[model samples]
Structures are given as structure tokens and as C-alpha cells.
Target: MSTEQVEVLVVGAGQAGVAMSEHLGTAGVPHLVLERDRIAERWRTGRWDSLVANGPAWHDRFPNMEFGEVDPDGFAAKDQVADYFADYAQKISAPIRCGVAVTSVRRNSGRPGFTIETSEGTVEARFVVAATGPFQIPVIPPIVPDSAGLTQIHSSSYRNSAQLPEGGVLVVGAGSSGVQIADELRASGRDVYLSVGPHDRPPRSYRGRDFCWWLGVLGLWDLETPPAGAEHVTIAVSGAHGGRTVDFRELAAAGITLVGRTAGHRDGVLTFETDLAANIAAGDASYLALLREADEYVDRNGLDLPAEPEAHLLGPDPACVTDPLVELDLAAAGVTSIVWATGFTTDYGWLQVDAFDEHGRPAHRRGVSTEPGVYFVGLPWLSRRGSSFIWGVWHDAKHIADHIVTQRGYLAYRAPRPPQ
Candidate 1:
């Protein structure tokens, strides 16, 4: 029945949590970070075996910590990233209590704080910062049919093709993970059907450099997302020979049958809308717009950057959809496996608060939660588009730390440090 109290509680231990802890430490604030598993647990168990970061290691680290002395432009694989986070945790001596699953967070009536009940015990937190990184649970469509007898998997649990049953694979979602997994499966001689949706189609390299380089110089990360929709995005990056891209066009060209977004499913038959052309066009438009933005940025900055190169791997042409698949008979198509690359949604089920919206997402202006003494970090568009990224969430961490110190009078309770 062990219980403790802390001035602040950060509810995760990934990059966001670790970085937030570092910021608190720098502010001389005594905070405890609790995680259900080890630090970077999501990166360890959530990703596939062949997954690599969408961006380079040189630019992916948090403030004051460098990915130091590594390949400046190389993409780190899954294990490498896990190691990186482990190393970062070690470097800062982050105050993280592993294997502590927080099961409840309720308001306290006597004071401005939260009563957090965890697997280990309980925490009385003056201010609660929820850094519960993205992808709380796999977002499978409500329309998914009874895949009774078939081996089904969400992309998060899928490791490699060898683990799948010997038959065709139907991958739903055309995002990075979907595309990459489908491509890999197809390469390994499995007949793969990739269901497409509106996805960003940025090239692997724009000029003579990786597209990430251009994104930094173009000031795009600082721009506001349009009100209509989310900014075009994908982490379908690779570090193979000259780099492998996770483009739908490339996937289509590589013999993976392209289908439209999953509409619904009934009696082993999956229905799809026939809008493949429109989705492909939307992706192409985003890419072209990005290139134009980069070109204008180069001209404005007077930077001597090279011109954009020739067509990369047959850009997504709508003409590829001549024989599109509208309804797929799962059994007849020999689809023994269905990998739901659908996406993810955050879960605040245990956080007993009324701060969430209709979509079950926490309503926050920046990182400040609608509920007092509570805050959210590492969410898409939290402060900017990049706020969801490892390198971007630091901005919110610092802001939250400052807010706690200034608004909550948290720095008043910081414990004195011993002589170093």
C-alpha cells in the first residue's frame, strides 16, 4: 500500500515524457514520470520489425541532447531507436518509475491536484501532465466484418511476413506502415492487396537531398495547418540501397493490387468506394505544393539549392485504376490475413475528466487541458504539426514546464539539489 506525493506527474516515459522530465529537472521542479512498461515501450512493441524513422537521426533528438557523432543523414531502424531512447533516459537519469500502470486520475476536492491510482500505488499530483504519446490503441474501423477463422492483425502487432499464414494478405490503409508492410509482403511472394485512402505523397528526395532537409529550410514546420484538413504527412521512410520509399504509386507499380478505402464489411465481403483516382490525385497535389513551397523558400533565402529531379518511381497516376477492386470476397481472394493499418486514437479512458471532445480527444488550446491542473503533450497540432514528432514535442514540454512554474507556483516546492 505504498503511496507518494509529487509536485508534478508526467504520465509517460517515451521521448515526450523523458524530455518533459528533463525540462522539469532544468526548472528545478521535482516531478515523477510513471510508465506501465519500460521507457520507449511503444517504439519497442508497437512498430514492425522492418520499421525505420521517417526522418534522419541528426535532426530527431530533443533539445540539449544530440544524436551525437552518428551518421548525419541516416534513418535509424527500430532497435536503434529503442536504444537511442534508452540511452537518452540513462543520460538524463530521468525520474521514471517503470511498470507503473496508472489506472485512474480523478480530481481532488480539497486542493488543485489529481489523485492518480496506478499499478504500483497512488500519486498525489499538484499538476498532472499527460504525455501519453500517440497511438493509445489501434483504430480499427467499426465496419470491420467477422474475420472469424482468419488470422487478423493490426499493423502495430505485425512483425514480419514469416509470422503470417501462407496465403494472400489484404492490408487496409495506404499510410506509411500500410504501404511498407504491403510492399514487403509482396516482395516476399505474397499476393498483397493495398486499400488506399487520401495520404500524403512526398518524395523521398526533392532535390539532391532528402525531403526532410527541404522541410526544415522551407519553414513549413512553423506554418499553420489549414482548417479544412490535416497537413499531408507520412513516416514511410527507409535506409535501404539509396533509400526505399513507401509511395502508393510505387506500391501499385510493384504488383500490389490497389483498392479504395474500406467502406464496410458483411458476410466475408469487404466493400470499398471507387475513388482511387481522386485519392491518388490528392496525394500528388500535396507533393507538388510542397515542392513549390520549397522552391519559393530557396529563392527567398537565396540558398544555392539544386533543382528538383526527374520523376521518382512512376508518380501515382490515376490510370493505374483501370481494373479497380470495389468489393473483395475475403475467402475467394485467398486473403488468409488482414493487416489493419487503419491508424490510431489516444485513450484517456482511465483519466476521469471531462476534457475530451466528441472524438474522445482531449480539448486543449496548446498543451493546457480544459480541465484545470491537467495538460496534454505530444499530440498532433498541439502547438504545431510537428508536435507529434519526437523532435517537435519538446516545444510543448518546455511550454508546459513554464506554465506549471509560472501559473501553478510549482517552482516553490522544488527540492534542493546536493553539491555535485
Candidate 2:
């Protein structure tokens, strides 16, 4: 393989990777970004055609550049998001090596950096910022067997409601993706069965403002995340479907059968627990707790704003509280498709360094790894609740860039001179 060297090697070209590059460039750090495909691969390939960002465009801008004349209240399409990242890369002149896939990474035992093996060449980087991106590994049930006639697809691979076989769709998760897809299929006149899980179901807009506004105003964004109980619970926000809250109550009301956690599948019989009500209650409890905290904050600050927020937060729809479907016979019930929106995982096995814990997760401090110059970007719970979001990545990228520059003595650095 050929050889290349850079002061920093960024392992992705998504929003996070582009943001990292931009920040590093602003800090005058010499770096090159390596992308397996091209910029915005996830936006182009990972999402469905109708998928819109769960957050509005205004909240997802690049550092120092507010969304240019775009509707702040409107959620962006996948292509729109991809365009934003592309624009950011061009505006900052981010040095990207597209079509270069990082096969493996190892510490240069003799040097203070890393040796990253890629598709095109070997890169020796003083600092390796892994922004490999999310939805890395789709988590599916270990027990799913190959049924002769049924078609199954994980949410990661699912493009739309029309991709699956014509029959009832068993959507195995009640998070944003699952509900959105379920609603899509339901709207298409397909019978949808939603496997309920614990989730937070705050309204999309509360008190004449987006719920995100309340989160910002209440300092929930400041939360050091993987926030105790919220580590596993998904925030069920649906920007597609008119930016409304994807409440389980509404789903149940629409004739979607809400079942409990999938116990397993055996002999054409799919088993689910009787804990659907419990899961819904758990989410409502958390939702109420969040509202209580926000209420206290507003009261203490004398911010006498909207009175409707209390109503929105306190009111629980009776439809959401429901009995669980204990089990369903897949063959008899005519459930021909199963979509697992079970979430994602990552594999750091390619990294030769000991950057992982017993659980095989990257060990890092606010994007900075304990393993010297090796860092991570776009990791959930990296520093704040927003770390995985576009807004949160900015903070983490800024910190990572600052640390790399300050520690490696790059602050007084200058941009490379143009070719004569």
C-alpha cells in the first residue's frame, strides 16, 4: 500500500467529521479527513426517502454559520442535511480523502500517534479522531430464525413501508424510527403491530414553542448524558409526519397493537411479555419528572411565560395506558414482515489499541481518549446529552480540536501557503 502522513487523521466525512475538520482547520492544525465513500454517506444511504431530521435546521448548523435563510422551524430532509455538510466541507476547504476506508487502526509503539491502515494507503497520524458515525451495528434479536415465507429487515436496512412483503408488519420497537415507520405503513393501509419499549414521549411542541426550546431553556442540554435512566430510552420525536410527537397513545388509537418486549420467536409463534403497560408508565413517569424539573426552574427564575406547558406535560392520554399483547402466531396472524428498530452498536475490534472497556466501548473523556492522541467524535454520551446530535458534536469537536492543538503545540500554526 502507499503511504501518507498527517498531523491528524479524521476517520469520517459526515457532519461530525466535517465539523472536526473545520474546527481543526480554524485551530490551524494540519489534518486530513478520510472517508470510505464520500461526505454525507449516512444521510444519503442510511435514512429513508421521506426521513427528515428530528431537529429543525436552525439547531443543526455548522459552527459560526447559522443555516443560510432556511426555515428555522422546518426540519430538514436527508438531502438537505447532506447538502449542509457538503457546503460546510467546501466552505472550510476540509482536506478529505474520499473513497478511502480505514480497515484497521493500531498504535505506533515507537511514536506518539497511530498507524491507520486504509483501502488506498497506510496513514501515520499524530492524532486520530474517529468520527466513524452512528448506526454502526444494527442490533437484532439473537433468536430470529429464517422463516420460509416471512421477510425481515432491520430499520437500518429499511427504506420505506413498501419494501416489505404485503401483510401485517411487526415493528419491534416503539422509538422514533419504529413509530414513524409504523405510522407510514399504517397510512399505507398496512396493519402494524408495535412492540412497545420504554421511551420518553414529551410533546414535539409544548406551550407554543418546540419542546427542544424548553429543553434548552431548562438546561437539559447541559446534562452530562447517558443520563442515568435515559441511557437506554429513546426520545420519540417524529419530524416526518408533520413534526408531531409520535406518542404510543396515538399509535394504539390508530389500531396498532402495542405488545411488550419481544421474548423470542419459536415454532411460528412469537412471544412477547405482559409489560407493555409498565413500559408506558415508566416513560410517562420520566416525562412527568422532566416537566417537574422544568417547572421548578421556571418558577425559581420567575419566567412567567406559557401556562399551557404545564397542561401538556401533566396531561396523559388514556389511550396510551393499555393492556399488552402477550403473544402472536406469526403464520396464523398473517404477519409477513418484521422490522427491528432495535437500535445500534459499534465494533472497535479493528482498533489494535486498548481503547475499549470490558463492554467493548471506547474509553474516552469528553472526546479525548486516555490513550494519548487518539480521540472520538460523534459518540453518544461523549460529554453532553446532545453529543450524538449535530449541536452536541460541535461542542465535542471544539474541545477535541482545542486539546489536539494546545497539547501538540499547534495554536500558533498557520495555513499552508498556496502553490507558487
Candidate 3:
């Protein structure tokens, strides 16, 4: 196939791609964005039906637009979030081609940039930006052997409780997705057993402010690395039920069983560690530590935020945590389905470049790769703690766009100027 040429080529058309396109357009850089599916395809399909933005609508949006007339504190539905990106792309007049999948990306030895092979055709570009987000590949651990005969699904494919087999569900992983799925399943009258893991529990709201606000003001969001001892900790906050603190004990009281980390499964029987109590205590400690930091910040600044005394009090441990069930027979528990919310990892198999590290992850300094003309955007902690979401992606995209312009000896074009 004949190859088309462009100044820049961007892969993926989600929030990151669209944001990058917007900045690139402002910088007068000729670029084309390629998407394998429709715009915002992940939000429209990868997420569960009841899924909502983990961040509030006010804070989850790009700086150029608000989330319509929705309440700022409320969570926007998954479809709404998708539409937001689609609309943003349109508003910015992004040069995007949906249904175009990038098959391979390689350094063009004969040229100064990359040779991008796409489903439509090949493209030679002076620069390339891999704007694919972090959640590329869903990770489902092989804890449950195939002989178990239980229907298995990843949280990414889960739609609603009605989609599962007519029985209990064993949700492995207690991060945001796991807890939300478990909560929804139990509310739909399905027995749910959530596997507890190392997680950080943050209140949805405290002191008349959202926990996200606290993180922002306390500078937690800007930290390049997680706090000491919080490494690899999954946050257990939820936007469901009008936004509420995720208390596994409360979930237990509501008839959902909370189990410790899953060890292994054989012949339809699952085994768990006897560390449920420790996991709960660890979450509580993180919660209290966050509150203490916020309290100290308040005292230092002499802010008028009211103290939330109840937040500091820990209620009695639930039976599931104290005397946890270490073994569970899937058939006995009536669990016919299993939802693995373990998490995701990036996939750069298509990119045959030296831009990755030994671990197969993109190695870059604030989105600028060591390889010239190779840039990455939208990976978590790529620049700051807020590097993945809509707001953060915008800033990261601008930084990348600026870097691209500066590298090419073009003057940086700031926004708020009339389009040429």
C-alpha cells in the first residue's frame, strides 16, 4: 500500500489522544489520530453499564468544557464520559480517523521519524505519539484453574448483575472496580464474595469536601511516588450510592461476604489467606493517616473546615474479618460466576522500538521518550499523580505538544489565540 505522510501521527482516540490532538492543532502541527474503533470506545464498551467516573464531574473534565448541567459533585455515567470526549474532539476539530487500527510502529531508518502501519494503510510521520492509556490489557490471574468450570469474566467485560449466571458471584480483587461490582451485585440480590487485597480506603466526602479535594490540597496528587508503605495499594473509593465511603464491614452487614486475598482454586474450591483482619486494619490505618494529614493541613492553614469526628472512630470488626472464611466451595456457595477485577497492564507489542524498558513498559521522561520523535501520553504517573484522568491528561498533552514543537525548532503556540 502506498504510504501517506504527515507531520505527526497519534495512536488511540480516547481522552489522551483527543487532548493531544487539541494541543497539536493549537501548535499548528499537522497530525492525524487513528482509532481502532469508535471514539471513546472503551468508555462505551469496556466499562460496566453502571460504571461512573471515579472523580466528580467538576474535577473530571478538561479545562475547555464542563459536564453539561450535571451536579459538580455527582459522578458522570460512563456513557456521559464517553460523549464528553467525543464532543470535545468535535469541538476541537481533531484530525481523527476512527476504525483505523495501528498494526505496527517502527523507526524509519531512511527518514527522520517513524513508519506507522495501520489497518487502512501505512503512514510515514515526522513524529509519533502513543496516546494509548494505561488500561490496555485486562489482567485475570490464573488462580482459578480451568477445571473449576465456573463462568469467568473480567471487570472490563462485566455489564450488569443480570448478565452473570443466575447464582452467586466471587469477585476477586477489592480495588475500586471490585468493590463497586460487588456492591452492585449484592444490591441486585446476588450473593457476592469480594476478595480483599491490599487497598487504601478514602472517604467519598469528609469535612464537607470530597476526598479528591483533600488529596489535591494536601499535595498527595502531585507526588511522583506513592506515600511510604502505600506502594501498590489500590484505592477503594466509590462513586455509587451518591458517593459514599467504601466500608467492607458495611458491605458485610448488607449480606455480602468479604474474604481475604485469593490464594488458589482447585476443583471448584477456592482457598484464601487468613489475613482479612490485617487487610482491614491496613485500610483503616491509611484512612486515618489521610485524615491526620488533612487535619494538620487545616490546623496549619487555620482553615474553617469542620472536623469530622466520626471518621476517626473505627467500629467493631465484622465477623468476616475477625473469623474469616479461609476456604470456599464455589458450588456450595452457589457462585457460578467469577469476576476478576485484578487490574490492567499496558501492551506495546505493536511498537517495535527501543522506547520501552526491560519490563516492557514505556520508558520516558515526562512523556518524552529517549528515542527522538517518539512520545507517549496518558500513562499513570507519566508526569504527575493526575496524569491519567481528563484534567491531568490535558496538562500532560500540552507539555508533550510543547516538547514536540521545541524539538522541531518551532515556536511554542499557546492557546487562547485565534486559529489560523
Candidate 4:
């Protein structure tokens, strides 16, 4: 196979890869970016239809460009987000080659670099930045039994409710994606049953400001790891209906049956834990904690923010919580479909480097792996709480680029002088 040499090689031409290219160019590093599919392929195809960004336009963008014509407070459609990254790549003239997939990466023999094997050819680079953002592989729990032959799909493959079989849909997982899908399915007049799980219910907007703004001001977004009891908590906020807080109680009142986490399956019958009320209560506790914190911040700083009188820490328990279902016969409930919005996991089998932990996650400190010259970006909590955000990726890219520039012996590979 043909082989080429480059100073740096970045994998995945999504927003993270593109951002890395921009920073490397600014630092005058001779690098090339490779993508398995088209640029922003995940945003282009992996997401469900009718999905919008979790965050609003203004806050979920790169520093170099603004989402033109998109309302600052309004969430942009998924296609709009993909288009924004594509347009940003064009504006910056990012050196990206799409449709070129990297098959594997191994340490170069007798050298201080890596040998990357791609579908097109081979590339030898002194540094490799795995910008393949989070949400790489869809994760579907194996709790569902195989005996029951029903239509099942991951959230990544789910498109619309109209395409589903005409029957009740059981959406397992109460994260942002799960809740959104359940809401959409229920709106389409399908009987929807949402499986509740540990989640954080933050207000979409509070005291005349978006929750994102409050998080920023309150320094919650800079945390390196999730708070205690929230390690597996999925954020249960929605940007639909012009952005609103997701209330499971209200959802139950709106006719969507709520069930606890899936315990096991037997004889075409699914068993649920008795934690429905506890799960909802946990979410409410988080919601109230955030509001109290925000209220204190406003009062301490003497900021003139409006008060939400209706915002309370407690309310009457919904029927789903008070009397949760312990089991459901798929046939009896008429549930014909299941949408698994469990979550995603990264696949680094192609990366043949000892830069991972026992759990197979990259063992890195703020994108810098213990294995020299191997870097990571665009992962949740990589460096901070917002590391996976658009702007967060951009900043992390800059930091990685800077590290590459300042490393020892980097002066030997400085940019070549232009022709005189």
C-alpha cells in the first residue's frame, strides 16, 4: 500500500476534527484530517429526525463563527447543526479528506511516531489526535429478551413515530434522547410507556436566563467529573416546544405511563423495579437543589433576576410514581415496539496503544494520554464538563495544539519557510 508522511494525523472529520485542524493550522502544524464518511456524518445521519440541539444556538457554537439567522435562544435543528459545521469547515479551509476511514493505528517500528492504516493507504505521523467525539457506537442493553419478536431500534436509528408499527411503544431510558422520543411518540397519539431511570431534571430556563447560563455563572460546567450520586444520571431536559423543563409528573398526567428500570424478562413478560417513585424523587431533588443554588447565587450577588414563584421543591406524587407497574405483558399491553435510548460507547479497538484504562476508556488527563504523542478530544468530561460541546471541543483542540507546539524537540519540526 502507498504510504505518506505527515506531521500530525487527526481522525474523524466531525466538529472536533475540524476544530483541531483549525488550531493546528493556526499553530503552523502540518497536519491532515481523515473521516470515515462525510464531514459531520453523525449529525448528518446518526441522529433521529425532528431532533434539535440540546443547547441553544448561541452557546453551542464555535468561537470563530456564529450560527447565521438562528435565534440565539432557540435550538437549531440537527441538520442546521451539521450544516453549521460544514460551513465552518469551508470558511476555515480545513484540510479534511472525507470518505477516508482509518482502519487501525499502531506505533511505528523503530520510530517515535505512529503508523496509521486507512482504507485509502497508510500514513506515518509523529502525532495523532483522536478527535472522534463521544457518541461513537450506540449502546443497547441486552435486557430485552429475544423470544419476544417485536420491532426494536436504538435511538440512533429511530426516525419518526409514523414509521413505527401501529401500537404502543416502550421507550427504555429516561435521558434526553429517551424522553424526547417518548414525548414525540405520545404526541403522535401512540400509547407510550417510558421506563424511568436515574436522571437530573434541570430547568430549561430559570429567572429570565437559560439553565446553561446559570450553570456557567455558577461554575457547574467546569467540574472535571459528575457530582456524587450523579455518575449515571442522564440529563432530562428538552429543547422542544421552544425549550422547556421536562417533568415526568406532567408527562404521566398527559397519559404516558411511567415505569421503573428494566429488571429482567421472563415468558414474554418484562419486570420492572419498584424504584419509579424513588427515581422521580431523585430527579426532583436535583431540580430543587439547582433552583436553590441559583436563588442563592442571585441573592448573594444581588442580581436583579425575576423569581419563579411557581417553582417549588415538592409536589403531589403522580399516579405512575405512587402506584408503579411491576410487570408488563408485552402482548397484553399491546406494546409492539421498543426504542432503546440507553446511551453510547466509544470503540477504540482500532487504536492499538496502551492509552486506555481497565474499562477500555482512554486513560488521559485533559486530552493528553500517558502514551506520548497520542491525544484525545471531543469527549464528555475530557477536560471539563463542557468538553464535548462545540465550543468546548474548539478550546480543547487549541490546548492540544498548543501542547504539541510546546513539546520538546518540536522546534525541529517547525513550519518550513516560504519560497523567497
Per-candidate RMSD, Å: 4.6, 4.7, 4.7, 3.4
The Cα RMSD in angstroms, rounded to one decimal, for candidate 1 relative to the true structure is 4.6
Candidate 4, 1-420: lDDT as tens digits:
568999999999998999999999988889999998999988979988989998999899998898997899999998999999899889888889999989999997886899999999999999999999878898988887666788989999999998899999999999899999999999999999999988899999999999889899999989988777666679999898889999997888888999999888877888999999888988998888989999999999999998997887466888778988999999899999999999999998889998999899899988999889999999988888888678889988999999999873554777879999
Q: Write the per-residue lDDT of candidate 3 for residues 226-290, one digit (tens) a residue.
A: 56776567989988877899998899999999999999887778999988888999899989998
User: In model 3, what are the clashing residue pairs, if there are any?
Assistant: none
Task: Give the alpha carbon lDDT tens digit for every residue of 1-420 in model 1.
Answer: 766989899999988898898889889888999999988888888899888777777767776766654576877777777778788888888899898999999999876778999987888988888889778889777776554567888999999999999999989888778888888899999999988888777767776667777677766676556336654344444554336545666677778998888887788888889887788777777777777777778788887878754542344464447667789898898988889997887788889987888887788878898888788998887887668667888888998898888865643578889999
- Global Cα lDDT for candidate 1: 0.80
Worst 10 residues of 4 by lDDT: 407-416
Q: Which stretches of candidate 2 lie over 4 Å from their true place?
A: 302-304, 313-321, 410-420
Residue pairs of candidate 2 with colliding backbone atoms? none
Report the error of model 1 at residue 38, Å: 0.4
- Our tally of clashes for model 4 stands at 0
lDDT by residue (1-420, candidate 2, tens digit) is: 567878998988988899899899998888999998879898999877788888877676665776664588988888888888888789889998899888998988765678889888788888888898656888988756875457888888889877887889899988888888888888888888898788887767765667777788877777885656668788777788558866677777787777888898778888888778888877777666766666677788888668554444434544424545677888788899999999998866667787777787888889888688788899888898878679889888999998987878653478999999
- Which regions in candidate 1 have their CA more than 4 angstroms from the true location? 68-70, 231-244, 312-320, 410-420
Ranking by TM-score: 4, 3, 2, 1
TM-score of each: 0.91, 0.92, 0.95, 0.96
> In candidate 1, what residue range of length 10 has the lowest lDDT sum?
311-320
